[model samples]
Target: MTIATELASPSPSAAAASSASSADSASGAAPAVPPLLVPKGEYPRPDLDRSERWQSLNGEWDFSSIDGEARITVPFAWETPASGIERTWLEAATYRRALAVPASWADARVVLCFGAVHHRATVSIDGVVVGTHVGGYTSFEFDVTSHLTAGRDAVLEVAVESPADKRSIVHGKQRSIPRDDYDGVSFTPTSGIWQSVWVEARGRTYARSVTLRGDSLKGIDVAVELAGDAPAGAAVRTRVLGEGAAPAAGVATDARAESATDAAGGLHPVDAELRLTADAAGRASGRLEIGSPQLWSPADPHLYRVEVIVGEGAGADRVVATTGLRSLEWNDGGLRLNGDRLYLRGVLDQGYWPETGLTAPSDEALLADLDLARELGYTMVRKHLKLEEPRWLHRADELGMLVWAEPAAPSRFSPEAAALFEDQLEPMVRRDGNHPSIVVWGLYNEEWGLDWDIPGSRRRAEAAAHAYDTMAALDHTRPLVENSGWAHVKSDLVDWHYYEPDPATWAENVRDLATGVREAFPVKLGPDFVVDKSLYGSDEFPRTGVPLLNSEYGEGYTSLERAWHLRWQTQELRRHDRYSGYVYTELADVEHENAGLLDADRRRKDWGGLRPADVNADTVLVVDLVPRAAGADIEVPLEAFELTVRVSHHGADAVAGRVEAAWIAAGAPLPASPHGEASSAAVPAVSPFVLGAPVTLTIEPPAASARLALFFVDETDAVRARSYLDAAPVEAPNRRGARPAPTPAP
Candidate 1:
C-alpha cells in the first residue's frame, strides 16, 4: 500500500516552538510534537548560516516503505521512536511533502537541503528527478529553482535506499541483520532521512561555499567560492564583529555571541576589513587578524565573530561564523595545546540516543551529553567509528571540549568498499574543518575497512596511509591517526588499545608497551579472538619518535568493578611518566557493551563507593595497593601497615607537597594525626615517596577496626590529592575460616 496522499499545511507556529520544545527535552521531558511532524528548528549550518532566507521543511511528511506505510518525521530515522514510525529495517522508502516558494523571492534561486540521509537518496520536485546523492553520514543538497512553482504548492518527494549488506558501504557503527566485524559494538541502523531537511532562497549571485581556519592563535584565514551571477570583479569581504567570548550573566544579546563568550568579553571593533577579489573561478581567500588574540581551551573557549559577505548590500550573500585560535603539537614527551603540556583525559562517545537512535532528542540533549562527559572529568571524547553531527562539534567548541573525530568506515576490504570509504573522507573533513575543538582526525579504527589486516595487505596499508596523507594535506592544523588503537602504519601519535583486567598483568603489559620491550602485542578483539599486532606499516612510514596513548581499555562484568578498574588502571598509566594519555572504554554504554561509566540512557551507573570525577581529575593521589576484586577490602591484625604513595600531577606548574595519612572508623572517635600534618618529606611535582620515617603506620590501642587514609597536601596548605584504604582487624580463629572483624563506624 503506497501512501502519498496530500497532507495538510503545517502549523504556522511550529517554527517558533523549537526553543520551548528544546527546553522540554532538557529536563528529560517529552516535547509537544517532539521529533515527530515538527522541525527541531535548529539552523543545521552555523558555519554558513543564512537564516533570513531559509525555511525548514522538517515538520510533516508522508513515508512509505516495502514493510509499511505511516506518517514519519523528516530527520528521525524510521527505526527510531522519535520518527513516529518505529518500523524495523527496510531496503527502501519514499518521503513526500508539499512546499511553496514565497512569491516575493521570485528573482531568487530556491535550493533544497538535506543535512544527511543514510546510504542513498534521490530527490525530486513536482515529479521531476533532480539529483541523487550516495553515502549515509554526510549532507547533500540540490537546486530546485526551475522545478519550483513560486507561490503555489508543489509536491516534493525523496527516494531513499539503504542496503541490507554492510560490506560495500561506509556504515561505521550502524548495524543490520547479518552483523559485521564490530557486531558486538555496533548499534541500530539508521535508514532514510535522519537529519534536518530544508529549503533556502538564495540571491541571484551568492557565495557557493566558505571556509574559516585558525592560523595558530595569531590570525585567521578565510576562503569563499562564489557562484550564480557573481563575476571575477566581485570580491569576498570579511569583517570581525567581535572576539570569541560570551557576554556577562543575565545579559540579553545575540544567542550566537552569548553562547561562545567567556569572562574575557571578546567584543572589540575591527578598524579594517580584509577583502579578496574573485578569480576566473569566482573563488577568493585571504588572512586577517583579531584585535586581541585569545586561544581556545577547556579553561576558556573564546570565539571571534567573523562575517564573510560576497559582493555588497541587501541582496548579497552573508555567512556569519565563529572561530577559535589554538595550536597542537605531539612528540615523544606528549601532546601540547598552545605550548602547554596537556594530557588527554578522554572517553569514547558513540553518539547514540535511547529514543532517537543516531539523532539527538534535542540540541540540549547534545549539550547534556558533553556536560555528562565533563562531569565524568573527561577532557576529550573519541567519537568512535562515526563522524558526529556538526552541531555536536559546535557545542564542543562553545564548551571548550576537545574532540577525536573519525569518519564512518566500511567494514570489509574491497575495491568498492575502499573507494566508498575514500569518497567519504574529503566531505567529512571539509564539513568539520572549521571547528577548533576537533584536535585529531582518525582515518580508521583498528584497520576496520582494510579487512582488519593492515600488516598483511600492502595495498590496505597504503590505502590507510593514503587516507592519512589526504587528511594531512587538507588540514595540517591537527594530527592524523592513520589507524587508531593498533597497527599504526602512519600516524602522528602512536596509540594502542588493551583490555587486560588483572591489575598485575595489566600493569606489566602496559609497562612493556610503553617501554617498547615487546615487538609484537596481542589485540583482544573479542572474548574468543586475539591477534598479535605488529608495526609493519612503520617500515615505510616511521613513527618511532611518537607519543604513546592507551586509546581504549577497561572491562568489567559489572559497573562497580569497571569503576574499580578505572580507579587503579588509570594510576598505572600515570605510574609511568611515558604515557601521554588514556581513554577508558567509553563515557556511555552502547547497546550491549556495559563498559561505559554511564548507561545507554546517559545516566550514571552505580560505581559502588568510587567517584569517577575524583579518580579522573588532573591532580590525584595514587596509592600502591592492588586488590583482587573491587569488593575485596583489606585485612589487619593489630599491627603496622605499610604502602607507598605517589602524586600524579598534570597541573600547569609544580607544587611542593607532602603525603598526609589518617585513620577513620565507623561510629568512633577519630584517632590522632588522623588530622595532624603528614610526616612525609615535601617533594615538588609528580614523585613517589614513603610516608613517615620507615613508611609504616602502627595500629595501636584496643585493636579497633578502621580504615587508613592518605592525602597529598601542597606547601600552600592546599590538599592536592587523597586516597584511602578500608581495613578491619583479623578476628580470633573460628570455624568461620578466620574472617576479618566487621569495619567500625566513624
Candidate 2:
C-alpha cells in the first residue's frame, strides 16, 4: 500500500486554522477534549519538530486501572475524562498496545520517547523489558533499535504505579486525600501517562539535544550533544531559518516562507567542523554570527528561528528551535533585563483545568491562560509547584512572558527521595535550559520536600544548600532560589510571604525590611503548623547582597479587594528601593482559594460591583487614597477627599498619554460621559514612575458606596492604562469566603 504523493502546501493562515480545527471541534460548553478518537498525529515537540521522521504513540491503548480494565487515551492521564477512564486517586495502571515499526525506519536507530509518565513507569516491548523511569514530570527515552523486528508487529506494554499519597514522589498540588490542605491549595491527583509519547527515527549518528544561547554582543552559541558512533569528520552547521532575500539552501520553500522568524529570517548559515579527537566526548559546539542582532523584550518578543544540522547533506539530522537574544543580570538590589532595571509584576499560575486536571485539554487552552495574564498586564508568572509541558514554556517565550519555573515536591524527605530527585534534576535542567522565558529556577517551595517541623534545621539547610549547588552545576545561566518563602540556606535570592490585606500594614512591613529589621508578620497558620522563629528572621542567616522579595502576598476577600489590594501592594513594593519584585497569590481562583484577580475560569470579578479591567493596566495611573485617621473604623473612610496622581508604566516600553480622573457614585444620575480635566506626561517604562507634582482630585463619596477611577489614554482616546478603587458605606467582611466554583470566568 505504499504510494507516492505530492500534496500542495498549506498557506500559513490555513495551516493555523486547520491545526486549531481539531480542538475547536471537540471543545464545547464543557472543557475541551482532543478531537482524534485515536488521538495521536500532532508532533510532540514543536521546538524540534521533524514531522516526517517521527511517529506519535498517542491514540488508544489497552488499559487496566484498579477500578477495571478499559481502553484509555495515550497522552491524557487516566483521571481525566478525555482518557476514557475518569477514575481519580489512581493507585496503579497497566497499558498495553501493539505498535508497528515503519519499514522506513529499518535502517535508522529507533528511539521511543515518553514526554512524561506519572510517578513510576516500566516499559516493555514484545515481552522484553526496555526501560523504566521514576519521575512524573521529566521526559524519558529508550533506544529500541535492536529489539524491533523489521517486518513484524511489536507489543508495547507499560506498567505505571502512582500512589497519590506517596511521600517520596514529586507531586505538585496533587492531593492524596480530597482537599487536604487548610487553605485549599491542594488539588485532585493525576496518575499514569499525562503527556505525549512517540517514536523518533534517526541516523546512526544523530543529534541528541541542542542548547542555544545568545546576547547583544555575541552571536548565537550552539552546543550539540551527539549519540552513537562518531563520524571521522562530523560537522555542526547553524542556519537562521530565513536570511537575506534568497531563502536558505536545503530548507523547504514553503517552510521558509511561513515559519516563525525575524522579517528576513536570521543571518546566513554557518558551519563549524567539530574537532572530534580520539578521546572527544560526543559533544560539538559552534557559533552563528548575525551582523544585526534584534534584542528580545516583553514589548517586542523578536525571535530567531535556528536550524541545527549535524553531519552532511541527505544523511544530516536537522532540528529547529526558536531563540531570543537578550542579557539578564541580578545586581544592585534589583533585576536587570538587557541592562535595564526591571520589576516583575507576576501572578502565581498553578496550570490546572476543570476537566483535564494538570493536563491542558489543548494548546489553545495553554495559550488562553498566557493571553489572560497579558490582558491583566502582568509581565511574568510564577509557575508555582508544577513542571509544565514544554509547549507551555514555548508559548511564554513567544508571548514575551517571563517565567519562574518550580519543580514539584514530595511530602517528606528520605535517602530514596533525594536520589529520585537528583535523578530527575539533570534532565529537568537540560530539557528546559534553552528557554529564554525562564529566568529563575525555583529549587524548593516553602520547604515542602526538605523538613516539616524544624526551622533553620542543620539537616534541612544542608539539603537546601546541596540542592542549590547541584542546580547551579546544571544551569549557571538562571538565578536560583534555594527555597522560596522561608528556610533559605544558600541561594541567589531569598523571599518571604505575608497575606496581610491592609495597605498600611503592608507598608509597615516593607519599612521593616528596608531598615534591615527582621520580624515575622503575624498571620494565621494551619493547625498543623509549627512556630519556626529562625525561618522567619531575615537578618539571622542573611547573604550580603541577595535581593529580597515579598514573593508571595495578598489574599483578598472580594474582587474589589483583590484588585485594590494588588494595585496598592505593588505600588508600595516599588516605592521602596530595597525590594526586587512581587508575585501575587494567583492569576485565577483555584478550588477554595478565591484570592485570584480572575475567577476559576479566568473571568472578571466585581467583588459585588467592580470591573477587572479597572484594576489591571500595562501603564497604570496610580492615585494616593486618602489616609484614614489613627482611630478610623478599621475601614477606609467613605467620605469626600482630595488625592494626588502619578503615571506609571509597568510594561517594558515607555508611554506618552493624556491623564484623566473621575469619581462616580453607584446610584447617582449618570452623566453623558466621563468629564475630567486632562494633563499630558511621558511615563517611562517600569518601576519608577513619572511623579509630576501629583494632580489633586476633589471628589465626594456618594450617599452610598462609589468608585474612584483614573485613566491614561493615547492620542486616539483609547485607554492605555487605568485603575479604580472601591469606597464602601460601612466596614464589613466579604459577603462570602472561599468557595470552589466550576463555572467559567465571565
Candidate 3:
C-alpha cells in the first residue's frame, strides 16, 4: 500500500467546521503560526515502486497551543521551533493538518507514512481513530483508503506526549539538566514530529520487500518477496540498469504450490510461490549476470539500478532499487576489500542540526555533509552511536562513502533492552545491506550494555556475536565489528579506544606495547583486573611492516594557540606511515568536549591560515631509550636543519625523562653545560614532561641548528638509550652538511 491514502484528508465540510471552531477559539488573533514545514526534497528511496507516487506533507500548517484540548501543528510538536508554539512544557499536545486526496489516487490504495514521532503518537482522520505508533526513530504507516472521503479534503490530527526523565525508551546521549545542562543552562525539551510526514499510492499485490547481496567486485544478487494473490501462468519480470546501460529484463514462471521454511523454522519464505490454477503453482527465479561490475569504493562511488515487475495474468507492478557491489573479509593480517588490503580513513560523525536537531532542513544539507567528507579526503566515517534516517545511507551508497553503522547504545541493557536493540538493528541492516558503502556493522560501543562482570560480559558478547551472525546470515556481503571498544571478545577485528595525541608516543608506547602484549602475552588482566583475551593471536597478527591504525584519537581541547598560530598542525601531526588514521574527538564542540574541528555554526575556525608540512623534506628524530646517562653527549649532523625530534619508550606510555641539548661545532666537545639549567637556550629541557610516555619535539627553522648535536640524560641511568636517524633529506647537494631549510612565512 502507498503512503498517500494513509493520510488522505477528511470531508471538506468537517475540515471547514474544524477550521471555524479553531478560528472561534483563537478569537481571530492570527492563531499560532507554525513554521513552514516544506519537504527538504523528494523521498530518498526510489527503489520501491510505491515511492514514486509519494508526496511530502512538510510545508506550512495551521497551529494552536493545546492548553485545554486545543490543536497545533503536527509532527513538529509544541516545544520545537518549527511547531510555532514554543511552550517549554506541555502535559499533552494535539496537532491537526488538512490534506486533500489526489483525484488520480481514486482507485489505488492510499497510505500515510510518518518518518518519526518523538514519543507516543495517536493518529485520527476526520476525527475517527486510524492508528497509533510508538518509538521515535522508526517509520510507521497506516492504510487510510477506507477512512478517506472521496474527492473531499480531510483533517489529520495527531496527539503526542513526551515525558522527561523516562528511561523505559531508548534515548541516546540526551540528558535533562536542572535549567542548566550546558554552560549552566537547563536542558530544553524535544517533543513531537521531528521528522517528515508524507503520503504514497500503491497498486494491489505490490512488491513487499527486496534484498540485494554481493561483494566489492562481484555484481549484487537480487532477491524479492511479493504480496497479494495472483492466478496461475503468471510471469515475474526483473531488470538491471546501470548509469550507461539500457535496462535489461528477465522473466520467471510462478510456482505457487512449493512450501518453504524460514531460518527460524517458520513457514514464511521471503519469496513464496503463487498458486495459479488448482494443482499448478508458479514461482519466478533468475539471475542478472553483470560482467565486470564497477566496484563501489570511497574513492569512486558507483551505483546500479535493479527493477522487478511481478505480473499477474493480465497486469503487473514494478519496483526499482539502487545497489552497489562490495565485499569485506578479515584474514590474520587485517581488513581486506576487493582482494586488496584497505585502510579505513575515517571520522566519527554525529549527525546533528542546530535548527532542526535530528531532522535536516533539506536533502542538500544531507548531501553537503557527504561532500565535505569527500573533499577533506576521508573515505570512511564511523557513524558514532546513533542510527540515521534511511536517506543518509542512500546518500552514502550514491556518493561511495564507506560507513561503519553503529547501534545506538542505551545506558543499561536488560532482556527487554536486548529485544528492542535487535528490533532496531535488524531493520537497519535490512534497509542498508544493499549499499556497498556500508562495510561494517557495529553491535556495541564502549561497554554500553549492562553487566560487565564475568557472566554478564559473556552474555553481552554472545548477544553481540549473535547480532553480527544474524547480519551475516541476512546479507553476507559485509563483515561485522562485534563491539567497538572495551568488553570486546574474539570477533572479526580487535577494536580499542585511547585518548592521546603525540604520534611518537602512540607509535612507540601504545602501538608497540599493544602489539607486544598481543604477541607474547596473548591474554592478561584488563583495567578492571578482569581476564581479557588477546586482540591478536600472535606477534605477527599486525604484520610488522603493515600500517597499525589508530582509529580513535584526539580528545584534547582545541588550543587557541593551535588555532591561531599552529592551525592544522595537530591534524598534520597525525599523518604518519605507522599511523593508519585517527578520529578527532568530534565534528563540532559538543557540550564539554571542545575538541571539535568546527564551531557550532559549522564554520571552520582557521580556514586558509596554515599550510601542511612537506612530508618528503621533513626530518623525524627518533631515540631508542629514555633517561640517558647524565653529561653524556651524542654528535649528529643536520641535513635540512628543520626537524621534529620524538623521544619516548617502545611502549604506550607518557614520556617522563628529560633531555638537555647544545649545538656543538662539527668537531668540538659539548661545552660543560654551556646552556645552564637546560632552560636558558631556545631549545630547553623542560621538566615534568607534558606528553604521554614518549615525547615529541617539533623544531622550526630560524632558531639554531647548523651541524646540530645534542646531549641527553634520563632521570636515572639504569638502561642504555639507542637513537636511530632516519631522515628524508632534501634533494639538494650544496646544502647537504647540517644546513637548515629555508623558513616559510608565518
- Candidate with the greatest lDDT versus the true structure: 1
TM-score of structure candidate 2: 0.82
Write down the lDDT of every candidate, Cα atoms only.
Answer: 0.72, 0.66, 0.49
lDDT of 2 by residue, 517-616 (tens): 7555564457566453333422456554777777788756667556556667766665555766778788887767687777777777764443333444
TM-score of each: 0.85, 0.82, 0.66
- Residue-level error in angstroms, candidate 3, position 352: 1.0
Question: Residue 92 lDDT in model 2?
Answer: 90
- All models, RMSD in angstroms: 9.3, 10.1, 15.4
Query: Which residue runs does candidate 3 get wrong by more than 4 Å?
Result: 1-37, 46-51, 61-79, 86-92, 127-130, 176-190, 228-235, 242-286, 312-315, 451-458, 501-509, 513-551, 559-582, 607-746
Q: Distance (Å) between predicted and true CA of 475, model 1?
A: 1.2
Residue range 619-678, candidate 1, lDDT tens digits: 777666675555444664355545666677787766566777766662232232237433
Q: Whose TM-score is higher: candidate 2's or candidate 3's? A: 2
Cα lDDT tens digits, model 3, 310-424, are 6533224456677766677766445667765555656667666555555655677766776666554456778766666677788888777788787654445566665555556
Candidate 2 lDDT score relative to the true structure: 0.66
What does the lDDT read for residue 632 in candidate 3? 18
